[model samples]
Target: MITCKDFLSELNEYLDEDCRDEVRKELEEHLDECPNCWVICNTTQKTIEIYRGMDPIPIPVGVHDRLLDALRMKSQIAPPA
Candidate 1:
């Protein structure tokens, strides 16, 4: 049985259909047996489906600038890896 940590670690690859067959099988089985993880996966899948069907709206310049500025400030505060 796969752990929740295992599910999360490979979630992006799984969603992208990028993981190997064996890993995918393990993740699918985990989803079947884990209610919390299943709910998370289901909601994320639905959200991605919804987004894919819509045209992406461009961010307003002011909002985009503010977001980048915030990110820069956060990075400055954070220690280097």
Candidate 2:
């Protein structure tokens, strides 16, 4: 049997259709019996849908270059593997 914690942990992958059939079935079963988890799942679904519905904005000019330079600096400062 699946539990609420398991469902939440797998929620992102499940919604992305990335989980295996067995795991997906387990999550579905848990959702069937758990009202609180079900509400969480529903709310997450709605939030994702709303975000998807919004128009995407373009990245500000030079943002990518600035980000890459910052990342390179940070990497240089980090200890060697």
Candidate 3:
């Protein structure tokens, strides 16, 4: 049986349908048995769908810089030299 950690680790590949057949089967089984994971997967899939259906919008330059700065700080990544 796959654990939540396993599910999360493979989530992107699973959603992209890029995993091997065996791994896909295990992930599906995990989703079936774990309601929390199921909801997370479902919500993420729906979010992807909604975003895909929308026209791409450009973020303002200041906001984009701020967002990147915030993410870098949160992840403890140094800004590019």
Q: Pick the candidate with the highest TM-score.
A: 3
Residue 62 in model 1: lDDT: 100
Ranking by TM-score: 3, 2, 1
User: Candidate 1 clashing pairs?
Assistant: none
Q: Provide the overall lDDT of each model, using Cα atoms, as 2-decimal numbers.
A: 0.87, 0.85, 0.93
Q: What's the C-alpha lDDT at position 40 in model 2?
A: 94
TM per prediction = 0.62, 0.63, 0.64
Backbone clashes per model, in order?
0, 0, 0
Clashing pairs in 2: none
lDDT for position 41 in model 2: 92
**How close is each model in CA RMSD to the real structure?**
13.5, 12.2, 13.3
Worst 10 residues of 1 by lDDT: 72-81
Pairs that clash in candidate 3? none
Model 2 C-alpha lDDT per residue in residues 1-81, reported as the tens digit of each score:
877777899999888857788888988899899999989999998999999899987888699768867887988755345
TM-score of model 3 (CA atoms): 0.64
Off by over 4 Å in 1: 56-81
